[model samples]
Target: MIDQTPLLDQISVPADLRTLQPGQLRQVADELRAATIRAVSQTGGHLGAGLGVVELTTALHYVFNTPDDRLIWDVGHQCYPHKILTGRRDRINTLRQAGGLSGFTKRSESEYDPFGAAHSSTSISAGLGMAVARDLAGGNNHVIAVIGDGAMSAGMAYEAMNNAGAMNSRLTVILNDNDMSIAPPTGAMSAYLSRLLSSKSYLGLREIGKHIAERFPRQFERAVEKAEEFARGFVTGGTLFEEMGFYYVGPIDGHNMDHLLPVLKNVRDAKDAGPVLIHVVTQKGKGYEPAEASADKYHGVAKFDVVTGAQHKPKPNAPAYQNIFGEVLSKLAEKDDKIVAITAAMPSGTGVNLFEKAHPERTFDVGIAEQHAVTFAAGMATEGYRPFAAIYSTFLQRGYDQVVHDVAIQKLPVRFAIDRAGYVGADGSTHCGAFDLAYLCCLPGFVVMAPSDEAELAHMVATAAAIDDCPSAIRYPRGEGTGADLPEVPKVLEIGKGRILREGKTVAILSLGTRLQDALAAADDLAARGLSATVADARFAKPVDTDLIDRLARDHDLLITVEEGSVGGFATQVLDHMTKADLLQTVKLRTLYMPDRFLDQDKPERQVADAGLDAAGIVKTALDALGIESAPDETVSGKDRPARA
Candidate 1:
């Protein structure tokens, strides 16, 4: 356990911290590291990344005029330390909780957090935009974008760099190279170059050249510039940033304050330097013993013992949805030699690592490049291989254009296993998988599916494996399965079909995804109120289960569709089919979907209830639609009967 320090107790915000001497900043960094560890041990959030950037975070705030000078953290996993320094230390323990601070950076959270970020590789673009805006407004405040080495792999970062170079925007990009991005980095040469370029002589000569260039004309400095570029290219491997038209600087030691403060001051003070890149190499989980040893496992953790570093995760009765998918996919791959699995730097998170263990040759862990991962899978599909491109639904949004252009347009047979397909808990609005169904179902020649339980997930996996003509997707939510027994031999579900779970009259409750459980609970609530309700699981979001939908519409007076996704998803598809079939004339329709608003971090149960997808909420919706007022004391299990007149 770390002891309370007088220095940290005195500092409430960065302004207070700025009054301290440069030598004293190290002490602040140490106390900040201890405080961050203690806070996350209580809150259970992104621990490793924040630990890695402690010195960098401290140095940035101390050097720059924050809140005025825009500082954007890429992916925002490393923002906990930033949050601690920026007047949020008092509420740091409330991170990722209901009515507390968010896990990621939010613009609404603080003025210091100029731009919000939860996704990877977006910092450069957002920071460049702020810098341009500042220039247009005639504001002289500096703009800095601190991004990870892993984030640089995405094409978006390069695109922003290209544009910033051309526009000659006065922006600073600090590359936080930790050599670990959820997984070990794929491109080692880029990592090596970052280390090699941090030499003292190289940085000194570069700084001298910058000063000279600012004072002199382009005509006189041409010969000297060619020599410097050649020397840099020959010895240190001229960074790709330089070729794109930005001034490149150091691969400094991020943990060393002496090195960081001076270099940062030089970069910040440099006049007319357009878009500088400072590559700083640091270790993930730098301070904590347990985290530094096993960085990946400690990246995201539940509450843990401060001394032992033992996380307090409760044992689950059933396997997680991710593990179930991996286990089933591994079994299928044993029989089918053509089966291959791909993940974009999230092998363990997506459960592709389990598949990799069985067939290392067939499993591909493409580094943080989602766009490249999608197209690479398309190429493999063209060669007659069954490729399972398992990615989180939120992360898949990054590769939507590729999904449409490469796979859908060409009719490739890439099986997309979209994990985390609904309201994911503590990660909040940014990580919620609410748009997959709406986006994928709109594309032609695609088969989209969502399972109600783990058993059904196995069946869908088999179904997706069998799809060889067109692209197919199976989306599942995060967390443990529904305690359903796994079949010895998984069955392949019929394409575009749904199954009825319960038969009734008057009202038919249709569920598209994992909300089937809630739908059934809502049925019980309706039944107790003397209203018979039918429950059906519309397994596939696309292909609408036309026959089952028609049966329900014809027999029932009211049809209420429930889904875990946002609007324009399963409910909209059902409504579209009903309108075309002219069933709206007879059946009254109501759709219960996620509200058109971004919900903050909380428990999954709370998120569901807030979204009105829970039993009580659904019951209330049905009662309101039927023009029946629900009694406050009514029971859902039919135990307490209301006297019928």
Candidate 2:
């Protein structure tokens, strides 16, 4: 080992970096980059985006006084470099580990992550808001929002831009146009940015215009500068942002601190109280060959070999839940004329690439526009086309209003194939599918289902299209199934019903989704402890499977509910139903669910353990609630079961 500790050893905080002379900034940048690579290699998190922003991160902290001059990063996946330099160097190795720093920016994590982000296109809006607040409070501190080019494609980004431009808040919006956000970002905003950058006079004229404006007296200078902003549009390819009233700076080379430092210094030092947009273009995975070629591969990865750039081998056999959804949806689309697929700029990430290829005409990528996708699907549904809006459960949070107002209120049959439903390993709280259940369950006439296996996901897709009365959604996890055998053909599962996977005695446990296998293991443990447990895959989290609940509560000793979602989710729904039926006092109850906190980053299993959702946790809870203690040979295995007394 060459011991990278020396490079990482020196960095404790941004204040430490300030101790170095101006010439030493690049040296510190190199050290931060190396430390980031070393740390992320061990932890296996957002490598490419972090790697790409190394110099930019170094330069921002170098030029601007951070924690004071709020530096807000969009999506926060690229915050690793920022985290490393901001006194968190030592905790880098535990990047996404339990109780460690979050992979995304968190308000509570550190002061460095001023405006926390997990979803895309939120930085400019958040930063502008902070800038306005700062002005109201009479604070002189600068506010800078760094957003990716991909994030700009989102309508909210434009909405924020349009408003910020008009308000002329003393804010700096750094557009890190790397042309990628997990995957290649699409839409017209991308093209507009490209054209703005391609204009030869864009940067030069903007600078020249600034000098001329500065030459005149204050009031005349302000009006003249405003006119130049209009004239510069001709020079800078129509300048949409300038028209919106922002002083557009550059589509400068982001990695080049030679370019970055001067521009940042100019922006920071300037008295321009109006919004200043600094468009910096950087390469995704800059300096890292493996990630440079394939940014998506390194976006949010597992432990990988640094030397060969190969991801650590997972157990072979079962397909990931995402892959299953993608493959099955594509195949089904081939057979059904009405079945079309849609993903919001996440073609490959959501496994809609298969659907894109299979049904090329039917496939539509809305480009970071989740709200539009929902409404678009609704329009398609009205035209007699079955649109499957394949979106991640977390990202769908952005489209809640659309789901309720556009889809559910009107009862449009838009099949939502929600991927990454449960505890995603590396991405942490921002990306966790924690709130989907509560949001989805609240909608009337919406048929929502989650599969206990990969096989059931395929069936749910078929079932969603078959229903024309109301909207339907099926949520699944990010990883592989439990190697459960697949059926030869898919079948439509009955809406609002559940399947009994295993039979037990006193305690009945409702497995919300794929957690059924683990529930089975826990049931075996319960039986061994002489507290017989029944396992049932509730299938539908929305409808609550009232029949299953009523029967189980009537027959079993205690009723237990388990789901990999936040509180006010599946268990809460169950409680509401049980209360509605006046069965609250009729049954002893327990619920194994995620807590009411922003559970930080960790592996899926570790998070489950941390949240008390593991097999041992389940067993302990069941034992405690049932008033059973001091059992014998009480280990839960996948295969064997104890005698069911």
Candidate 3:
């Protein structure tokens, strides 16, 4: 029944971990690996990373006094082991399922989690803050931050390191150099690590010098620190972090607890004050054969067979929505020289892979730095290049300030192909593209669109690319699009006009994005109860179709706006516009939007069902609000509903 094996279950807390002998640590690692495999097999989550970090997790928890010494994991993709040891083992079976544990690190989940993270490059800054706070509070606990090398490329990590070095804060950063983040990491930082680790003779000599320096007494120790800094700068061709201020350690074996424990113990006990970074190397998918063989496939997966590691995928003949976006962008770039694509180190995830391949010179991946990605796109637009800033809606939240300041304020024509723009399953609240519509819709002069199907998604992408306005965004969800045949390539949808899906009416439901299916289903069910309701896809969220919205309000007895995202999103924008136009008084208004709570994990449809954003629930809400309630023979828990497959 267990996937990897109980190398983890017998023990519960840090005290149990501390008691394990060095030889037993391997068993613990095995158990952690097995536990993670089993949990993710059932719950469907980011499995490959946790398996990769088993040894590192064991070493950190065993060697360091957790719940006393603080640990912050960047992005938290590699925290499953950390979670298991920190009294979360019992909850592991329910990982990422509805009413289950979150996939990312969450402070509310446990005391040891320290800081919650899903976004990258936040570990260093968060750890620095905790270390500084510990100092001010007179706490002697050591603060450790584990960040992947991919995250190291972000400027904020450097900012924290720079500030921490100057302040001489007691902190340690663990660089988990897997050399990959879904894909091989890019940028100067990744290249430097490769070069540094490649030259063994150079590294060996540097270590020998440090070893000899440790034997020196009193003033000699201070001299050694000074000499080491100069020698490092000279030998390493330039140390980005050490120069900024950090006691540099490693490029060590992250999976070898033998080396990790001693190094971690030394760093924890060392009287040497200020920031220290230990660069530990580990394979992304360490133990499992399939995962190690194809790390990206296992990076984030759905439920799979334990024996073969074969995922149970829904049969979709059509390509994923993101794939459609990428392919179209590639075709566009092939024809147009000015058309370029950019992603925040998420080339594949955001559907810009085609653009990257067809126009590699024009495509830029800024390495998990969304703020830089947005502003960089804005800068590119100024140079007479049309840059499609493709990014996931959740990640784009990081660039809100830049969007308002650098792009919107300057009126740059940066086309945002906002992928994964609605409820994201398995990865939970941290990954859900909940606030994008609300945030983008409110931005002055910004045009936002949510497509109903693959056809509209293609059209919207073309429309966004063609817009020379301040900024335009077309948000689409994850997974395969509805089986609708796509509209002709480069076909244009009227900028702010929405087409009505149905034309009946006691109630008119204005649907946004893929939730149009839910609206349609609800309308069908409502008709069964002798209630006819119109369904329309309100394609554009911002600069909303006032003429259509007002017409619906005047014609229908009830005007309902349904969206997958939280309330106050596109639906709220509709309300704001309707109120401004004095149209709210025209009809009884009802909005079917997700509740203003961080949604828990479940299948996407399940979460939507629980949140009352699905077909049956939508009908129920609409019927109730319409004061014409009809009792359905049966009802379903969004969770209880059979999955799409």
Candidate 4:
């Protein structure tokens, strides 16, 4: 490996970083950026964000006593550089690997990561909470929240800012404006202005002016406040933040250490100041040529060559599930003019970009407001438009209230295209689609469907599009689909009905979502042991297929329910139906699902295997339920292999 980060090698932690002189920080930032690029090239994580904040991360740690003074990063995408500076540089290359460093900031990982986050727009709120807690505990430590421009689109950030303003707390919010690209070029004047505004002298002078104005008549005081606001607003264009009751600073250049260090030091020294918003303009992929040239700024990347910036993405044997959803939806929209697509700031991630290519007029990119996206889709649905809200399963949790109230309660035909509906590798538990089944199945008049393969996903899209009276959702996992042939024309399947794939008499496997293939594999394993197992794909999680359940219960000696979801999902629904029907009285039943505890980052296959939702797990569960012990030489190892009595 090339030793490009000579300056970075000297620093083991943020304290080590603070030991360096301010003049040496520019070299440190350059080396840190190089180290970040080198690490991400090996591990394939969020690159552009970390690259953008290399200088800011250096300045923050240098100016403030971190771990003691709480510093929170919103969504934690830009924390890779922060991680490299804060005692985790050794594990930087092991990022997103099984049992290695998490892709996002994790509290358990290090003391530097004060708040854990993967979801956006939560830093300000968490920082305010910490600040308030510090005040109550009679601690005078600083609380700083670093949030991105994209994350500011969410209502939560604004709500936190509003609260912080009202509470008059000693908090500093760093608005990292990387996306807006609205700031003029920062030079000596702008940096000087930023330093002047954030300095303690200016703050004290302003407070004295306020007190002096208060001694005069009410009209005169009001005029003085307006004059001061107008002068500052005209110069910095921070009237909105000023109106929200925060002391506003500049849109300074974030890459310049000379500019960043002084402004940050000024803010840190302002102990008696209320909540302050420092607008720092940054460019995503600032130091990386390949990322800067790309349209999405290489926001998310795969393992790549450091010399060429060419990603080593595996060639898909079949179409990706996300692309299939997009193509199928676009095709449906061609025939039906009322079909519209909406996505909350994840057009490409959710495959809405494909939809936008064909039907540009009908597609809506609703920023990072999932709740607004949900309600907006409902509004379109009310106007007789078949609005498809394509969102990640984890992100849909942010808009559950809108899903329940605006769509489910009103019975609107908003088709929810839930992408990434299972264990997502690398992104970890925060992005896992584990609870969608549990949350959506509980809703009244909801048609929920999970596809087993690519063909099935296409068909389910048609199924959800066909449903007009009530809300419908079709969930599919991330990555490439199984090599199933796509139908020339997608056909709508019968709602609340399941199809039996194989027949047997000894045991039955009722599978939901992508676990159907695992169920079939388990059946094959059982067959090798002289056992016959029936495999059925329970397509609908909400509507329990009683007829199929009854037949499986009556025919098989052991019946098992399997799904790629949490405990209270498809398995719970099936068990609830079985209990009400008294089918549990005669037949032996078992359930295979994700464990109760939150799982950490790992490969998707490894995560499934660990959770006991794989084929081997199903086979073991079946054998254990039937009171038939496996031999010591069995394929599923590391278990107590008891001899048969």
Most lDDT-accurate candidate:
4
* Model 2 Cα lDDT, one tens digit per residue, 603-623: 799888777787887888887
What's each prediction's TM-score?
0.92, 0.88, 0.88, 0.96
Predicted candidate 3 versus true structure: per-residue lDDT over 474-589, tens digit per residue: 88898888888976566877878998978875779999899999899988888777667889998999878888898898777778888877766888788888889888667778
- In terms of TM-score, which candidate is stronger, 1 or 4? 4
Arranged by lDDT, best first = 4, 1, 3, 2
What do the candidate models score in CA lDDT, each in turn? 0.87, 0.80, 0.81, 0.90
How many clashes does each candidate structure show, in the order listed?
0, 2, 2, 0
Please give the TM-score that candidate 1 achieves against the real structure.
Answer: 0.92
Q: After the best TM-score superposition of candidate 2, give how far the Cα of residue 258 lies from its true spot, in angstroms.
A: 2.2
RMSD of model 4 against the true structure: 3.5
Q: Lowest-scoring 10 consecutive residues by lDDT in candidate 3?
A: 636-645
Which residue ranges in model 3 land beyond 4 Å of their true spot?
Answer: 1-9, 180-226, 233-238, 295-297, 631-645
Off by over 4 Å in 1: 180-223, 233-238, 295-297, 631-645
Give per-residue CA lDDT, model 1, range 1-645, as digits (tens): 458767888887788888999999999999999999999999999999999999999999999988788899999988999998888989999999998898989999998888889999999999899899989999888999999988888999999999999999899999898984322222444444443344455556667876797678876687677776676655444447678877665556788887788777776776567788887778988989999888483789899998989999999989999999999999999999999999999998989989999999999988889999999999999999999999999999999999999999999999999999999989999999999999999999999999999999999999999999999999999989889999989998899999999987767999988889999998887887777789999999998899999999887767899999989888988999999999898778999989999989899999999989998888888888877785445433222333222
lDDT of model 1 at position 430:
97
